[model samples]
Target: MKLIIQIPALNEQETIAEVIEALPRKVPGFTSIEVLVIDDGSTDDTVDIARRAGADHILRMGCNMGLARAFSAGMEEALALGADVIVNTDADHQYCADDIPALVRPIRDGEAKIVVGARPIRDNESFSPTKKLLQWFGSWVVRKCSGTDIPDAPSGFRAYSRDAAARMCVVNTYTYTIETLIQAGRKRIPMTWVPVRVNRVERPSRLFRGMGEYIRRSVATILRVFVMYAPLRFFASLAALCALPGIVGIVRFLGFYLSGDGSGHIQSLVLSSGLMAMAMVLMAVGILGDMIAANRSLLEDIRARDLLGATTRRRHDATILKLADAS
Candidate 1:
């Protein structure tokens, strides 16, 4: 088995070396362990330092893509390079390197396809009160969208089995953490979480500026997930919302007409008709979106199978080459 730890970096020349050096060369379940550094077009010397710190692979994007793109790129590279299990951690060393074994244990034991590290957010002294509350709320929204009971969703530190990693498709450009979890849950991938340690972040987050922005962005991800995975449900809810007011207006108009004041209720009838038309349009949209979602599911299944097969063949060929060399 091969385990590859991937760290996605931006302008993190300060901590990339420490992050790469701290990774363990040997884990309990894997014979080979390697470090992969993904430099997201850093202006600094992140690539050179990561190489000096014993990084086995370095992938540099042509331009400064966001974290989400960087992560997706590294994941694909690791899978192609025959990583049986992949661990994703921060470039700033926010997650403890010693805990990598625990992170991969769930996947190794066949317990979960995806395993996320649950940080002690409430007890962390680095978080302000408002930030803590926002974390809780953002996680709550993610839980609803993902339908998974994992305690933490915003934490980027996670481990994925080959199958799970291969199946992931991240459409969100701002962040991958929340969207990936939602994708896993909607796709019915087994998921679990274990408690992990974290170092206090010395610098402010580059992801977002304020807690309010966090909530807003998280909700946006939820909406996107809902639209992508559960489009019928989302649009149906909207149709129902429109139907309510339309129904009320129609009932009011009927009551007035039956009471001999029908002339004055013309405006009410017109409004009800407009609302009902809107409701019908929304319902039609929901049906069309559901059809598209079904097709998307089928396509994703085919893609996943093809990718997994390619990865498996690569691993097998690599093993044979090693044996031939040894002989």
Candidate 2:
């Protein structure tokens, strides 16, 4: 088995080397361990620093795409490198490097295909009281949305078994963490979480400008994923909202008509008809969205099979070459 640790770095020249050097060179349950640094169009010397710190692979992007795109690219490259397990961490070094073994242990033991590192949000001294409450609320919302009891939904520290990584398709440009979890939960992927330690980083977050911006972007991502994964339910709820008001209007019109004031109630009937039409339209859209969701699932499955097939063939060819050389 081979493990690849991937760090998506931006302008982290100051700390990228330390993050790379701190990684464990020989982790248990894997014969080879390598580091892959995803340079997301860093204008600094992050790539050079990572290479000096002994990074095995550096996948550089042409421009500064967001973390979601960088993560997707890293996963693709790691899979192509024949990684059995891929561990994604932050270039800011906020997560403890020593905790990586714990993250990978669940994958190695076959307990889960995806493992998330839950941080001590409330107990961390670096987090303000407001930040702590926000973190708790965000995690709670993600749990309800994902159907997974992950206490740290926004934590970037995570490990993905090759198979799980292959099936992951994150479309949200804001962040991949929540979108991926929602996808996995809806897809019924086996997942587990482990507690991990966090280091105190003095630098501000590069992902967002402020708490308000983060909340706005994160909420948008959650809503988008919810719609994508559970479109029928979302639209059905909207339909219900419209239908209830329409029904009330119609009942009011009927009551007036029975009381011999049918002429004045014609306006009420017209309004009710409009609302009912809206309800019908929403339901029709829900049906269409549900069909699209089903097709998306099938395509993901096909992509996963293709990735695994290619990995297997590469391994077979490597084994044949080794045998021939020995003979």
Candidate 3:
């Protein structure tokens, strides 16, 4: 088995080399270890530093596409490089490199296809009270959506087996941490978590423009994932909500009409009719959304097959070339 440690970098010229050099040179059940850096249009010397630190692969983007894009690119490159497992870490060096082995242990032992490096969010001193509350609330929401009991849903430290990597498709441009956990749960991928250590704050996050922007994007991403995967439930709940009020309105209208005040209850009839019409519309929308969700699932399957096939063919071609060289 081969493992590729991938770091998504923006402008970490100072810490990128340290992050790369700190990676484990060898791990059990892996024949080789390779370091990959995704330079997302870094204007600094990050690429140079990573190269100097002996990164086996560096994927440079045309422009700054954000962490999600850089992460996806690194995963694709790693898979194409015949990596059996891929470990992703931040370039800021906020996460401890020493915990990488424990992070990937479940994957190596065949217990999980994806492993999340859970961090002690409560014990972190860098987090403010508001930040800590938001973290806990966001993680709880993600757990409900993903059906996974992950403590640190926002942590970037994670490991994915080839199968899990191939199946990954990130639609959110803001972040991959939360969206991926939700996706894995909905897709029924075998995922687990391990406690990991983190270092002190090295630098401010470059991913978010500000706290408000981060909150907006995070909420949008969460809602998108929920609606995309559970459209029927989402729409049906709204439909039922409207229907309940419509039923109550109709009952009140009936009571007024039976009391010989039918003319006075005309407005109630109109309101009830409007509510019922809205309920019907929402139901129709729910069905349409459910159909679209099904089509999306089929597309995901096709994409996964394509990725797995490409990886397999790449490995096969490399093997043939090596045999020819030996001959």
Candidate 4:
């Protein structure tokens, strides 16, 4: 099987070559092993350095689009290249490159379609105490939402089978790590995580300005994915929460009316009516959202099928051409 390893780099001129050099040159795979570098609008010598470091493919972006978009682009190129599997790692070389075989072993064994390299968050010396706690909390929340016991939800190191790679669609521009897990879980894609080692911090993360910003963006991504995946359930539960209390208050106001002195309870009636109206709106929104989600799913399926067919045709054509040349 042809396995392509993708590194998403941005202004990493200093360390891009080191990251590329550390990559394993051989694995127990069927055939070729290639390196694909995604240059995310680097103004520096990152592209040139990567090229000199023996990168098989360098997909360059005109401007910085963020990690999620770069990842999506890399996956598209890998698919078009007829890769049997794809592995993603950071350009900072934070992850241990030696563990790549272990990372992809499960995929080779048919145990999972997607494999996440879990980090020892708490034990990492580079993480501050607060960062450690935040990491734990974030991973816990992701575990609950994803129904997968991934200890490192934000790790950039991961492997995807060709089928899983084709089905992946990163809508969030913030990051793909958490969003991909949530999508795979919601879609019932088989996933597994393996423990992996991480190197010391070479540079601060450029993805966020600070921990506060990261938390804000991460929470927004989680909520957005949840709504997109299960809009009806999410909004219906919210609607019930508002409407149930309003119904109770309205019933109490009716009792007050029958008792002769309902004038004092006018405020309660107004509040109840407002709440019921809000609940109705939420329910309507939920219904509309469900319809939109269905349409999005249909479109996603169509796109996946089209890409898969194209990849297959390209592979067949390449084989026939090779055979003709040989003859």
RMSD vs true structure, all candidates: 1.4, 1.0, 1.1, 1.0
| TM-scores for the candidates | 0.96, 0.98, 0.97, 0.98
Off by over 4 Å in 2: none
- Pairs in clash, predicted candidate 4: 1-30
Give lDDT tens digits, candidate 1, residues 170-241: 888889998899899999999999999998788988888977787788788778877999988999999999
Scanning candidate 4 in windows of ten residues, the lowest lDDT window is 24-33
Please tell me which model should have the higher TM-score, number 1 or number 2: 2
- Most lDDT-accurate candidate: 2
Shift in Å, residue 27, candidate 4: 1.1
Encode model 2's per-residue lDDT on 34-153: one tens digit a residue: 999999999989998899999999999988999999999999899988999999999999999999999999999999999999999978888899989988999899999999998899
Q: Write the per-residue lDDT of candidate 3 for residues 208-303, one digit (tens) a residue.
A: 767788788899999999998998899999999999999999999899889898897788889889999999999999899999989989998898
- Candidate that beats the other on lDDT, 2 or 4, i.e. the better one: 2
